[model samples]
Target: MTGSVRAAHTALALTNGLLIDGTGAEPIRAASVQVDSEGAITYAGPDSLAPEVASGTTTVNVGGNAILPGFFDCHVHFCLPGGAADIGLTMALPASLKVFQIAERMRTTLEAGVTSARDLMGVDVGFRMAIDAGVIAGPRLVLSVGIVSSTGGHGDMTQLSGINVLPYLQSPGCFPAVADGEDQVRAMTRRILQAGADVVKIAATGGVLTPTDRPDDVGMSVAEIRAVVEEARSRRGGVHVAAHAQGRRGIQNALDGGVDSIEHGYDLTTEQRAQMVDEGTFLVPTLSEVMGSLDPSAGPVALAKKALWQGKARTNFPAAVAAGVKIAAGTDAGAAPEHGHNLRELGLLVDNGLTSMQAIVAATRHSAELCQLDHLVGTLEAGKRADIVVSDGNPLSNIQLLGDPANILLVIKDGVVAKDRAGFLTDRPVSPR
Candidate 1:
């Protein structure tokens, strides 16, 4: 998302394309969009009826390409490297070097057509600030900053032998909060909000990635979970709370405790889906990581953990969809293939019964709502931020094309051409296809 394409346009018009708009509506054929200098959409609709572009506007004929809102990943861990769980090695990386790796991965994410990312863990406030200030070309970042876990919980990162290794790992401005009581949860919730977390992630249950825990083990009590959620609500900007819960009881406790969303709800049941729908708790199935965890190559412990939960996830996801649960897209990007392959999640969702268009909506408008950025992005509607992706094929017809970044011809963020592989797109107007 750099080079000459970065700031190639302020007033821009991309016309004669198929626009999905991210609204779950049918694609508008012969579509167009006009973006103003402020990076807001001035017009979006049929190309024949598009408003005139401002004087000096840069117009590019899209040549019948398929345009859609930039994708969104509601869960990610950019600082955690792929395919390994050596806390000692990870903690030993110098802070400066870790930041460099995070920044570099962010660039790859942006070019992959992910314009907005909600980092659930392992990213610090500094990275968010640097991305916002344009110090690095990356997606707009939403940060949870640190994870909150009970002692001996999934995020504890402490091993047997009483090593107390959890304290040794820290991301510049990020650190986990280990608390056991309601008082500790309340106090730590305030501290995390004070630390500039846009959201809060509570490990309400043991997770697959941890060494000594079963996925069905509920970690935090309902009272403790309620404390964190209620305290986070009291903070300014109404910070969101996402619960990492996999067990049935844990998922129910997190929902009752007021978590805004549930991440990797591996063992959630049909009854739970009904409750989630009633409670309006969005579910982010990080299916990519679940798929990877079952890859056999992720090692015995990882594979064993996933073995207990994958069956339920494989079955429960479609049930959740059938029950009309609010579902968003997330890949758990750091779990496998690291960055640059988030689009694979859409294909996974489709494999689990979501139509290509439904999966696209899950990644677009729905994911935006989960990230608390629906007003700013997620759709190519007038007055929204001009974050759009142009793909070589009509993804509604061949959704798998997105799994390959080369099919992504262009990526525009805030009216700037962040990526443009389309040789025909230039400052001057061109003939329609």
Candidate 2:
């Protein structure tokens, strides 16, 4: 082919691919996708009806590969390393080292076919800006800067310290803050927004990761949660709050407080599930975290937690599905098994009672809706960004293909091909770390 022919500025067409658009519809066979110079999909369907590719256009022969919308990881931490607690006293490492660690995590995430990620906590606004400016090779980011919690609550870093230490000398980073009362909660929420958070995250319940609190304990009061919701709404951005709830009362409080989504509904009751469906509240089960905790090799704490909670998750999952609760996918990446292996969440969802299609939707369209980014990403359709992933085999037949990056032949983000079988090649190279 001539150099001019190879250097196209117009449409880039992928022909003869099996298309799964992430809309819960049946797959389309022998399809083609035409992307314009502006990165919008101009046409997608049968190759026979695809718009003509003018001169100097690029073409890719998909050879019957399965093309689907890129995956989204709803719960991730871009600024914090995955095993932060494991680092112990090394947590005192300079901020720059933390930044580089995050950069590497982003690259690994993208390489694994996650084109977009919603960082639930511990990501600064500066990190988001860096990714947006193409200074880092990371997924599109929706970040919650830090978490707000009551004194000694799930996010209270103070709990991790020894009793001999003076609390006044402590200066917390992005992990969590100990705020109390409605006014304090409101102030903290605004502070997070002002600090560049896309959404405000609050610990409505105790957590498994933190040393002191029980996962079932209600950590934040209804007034505190409401203060955050009200303040966030006044900004017109409509803040989305992710509640790390694991108990019935905590779930109730989260729903009543106008939390957009409940993360890890480990202890929610049938009544609470029905209420969630009735109130239009979304649930993100984060099945992979449960599964990871069950792995005997994952260590005693994780294994013990899983042994205690797995039965609860098993009991709750089918009930939530039966109750018609809107479930989304999130793995709590960075908590265990790291960031890049997010797709393991999908398989775990399916294993936990979700049909393969439902699990896929939870990770894509449902996740986008939860993140309020459905208009920009999610389903593959005309006028949407050309963020696509092509796999060597049918992912529906075996979701495990998603867990391994090698099975993904292509990954495109914003109409730019970020990864091919040959490896990373782009006009603008964003350093991984």
Candidate 3:
């Protein structure tokens, strides 16, 4: 139950469960999933049609639990500690202490049934490499490494005291990401790419937390955003660009500049929603971050901004959902809710307009597609990575069940059991091959 790899029975199967599969399809009754030793799913369907596993393969009876694909969060910040005074707390802490906090957060996040995450900023490539090397327990990471911002933009750490505290938020592999015109934005984008960014994150508008600007204030111009998109696309693998677009003008500019996804769309217009659907653009609604930003410990400016936007966020997100825009679940963890509570976003999505199953797909398949890992994860099926989760009960009836880590019965990432709350693996002895 605690090892990095299963000892004798490398392959696994969870029989006698209801499988949700993350496909937005109706649940399959009497389901079973078979994972081969290589961490690939060999079978995932009705128990009647499931192929027989090898003799030594461990089989777990889930006691009629709900089986699902491991969840994925599209937007998260491992560096922030999800505190009301995040900026002050980060500035006060030493880099070494922050690293330990990041590790612990990642562990809790994985145990909460999140198998993969896309870190928007503040995390470097080293963390991803460490997880891949099995040096630590964490969800598979896709890192952005840095955020591209114009001077005094949301990502800029310069305060009224004339201190730039950006160093506290980044590791050695990250760059100081403040740029102005198109040329500077392009150079900054290249530097971030060289530092191993999987996605290019740019702030197209201001933010609530930054004292230097208001959320409605435009940050990057259309040409500057386009520069970032062009540079990222020129890369060998064609990196995608995500814009921190909160206001209507910034959102329109980002869409015009051809960014792949819009983050924190607090003022999304009806035209923007239609445009997003037509262009297949994804909307990552960080509702939890914005709504939870009304912490008493936050500064007066931040509190006021958060209060103003709270109503708009509730309205705009539901409108976007009704407009048929592609939705991806991203809590913007480390801002309000901590990493392990990522499932809270699903419930928020359901409240906004999405049904329970639609919200699950947004967290799983849609999020995977946004992270560019859909081919490997997102759904329970053959030829996919065996990143699976078994919930204590059906989430369709009560989606809030997934909001608590205690309800997550089993978490298997790449055929490795990361968390087994019900002793599904440890309770039974492995059969000899």
lDDT scores of the candidates, listed in order: 0.83, 0.76, 0.88
Q: After superposition, how far is residue 424 of candidate 2 from its true place, in Å?
A: 11
Taking the tens digit of each residue's C-alpha lDDT, what string does model 2 give over 1-433?
A: 0011112234578878888888999988888888888778877788888889766557777767788888898887655445434444435566566677778888789878898898877666666677767777778888876778888877775634554121221112453556899999998888888877777778888876665677888889898899988988777468688888887788788888988889889888988888888878889888877656433545677556667777888888878987889888888887655778888888888787788788888888998898888998888899888888887777888987888887776778777776776232323322221
Tell me model 1's lDDT, rounded to 2 decimals.
0.83
Candidate of highest TM-score: 3
Once fitted onto the true fold, the runs of candidate 2 whose alpha carbons sit more than 4 angstroms away are: 1-10, 83-85, 160-175, 294-303, 422-433
Candidate 3: stretches off by over 4 Å = 1-9, 86-89, 428-433
- What RMSD value applies to candidate 2? 5.2
In model 1, pairs of residues that clash are none
List runs of model 1 lying over 4 Å from the truth. Answer: 1-3, 85-88, 161-170, 293-298, 424-433
RMSD in angstroms, candidate 3?
A: 3.0
Best by lDDT: 3
* Clashing residue pairs in candidate 2 (N, C-alpha, C atoms within 3 angstroms): none
Q: What is the C-alpha RMSD of each candidate to the true structure, in Å?
A: 2.3, 5.2, 3.0
Q: What is the clash count of model 2? A: 0
Residue 115 in candidate 3 has what lDDT? Answer: 97
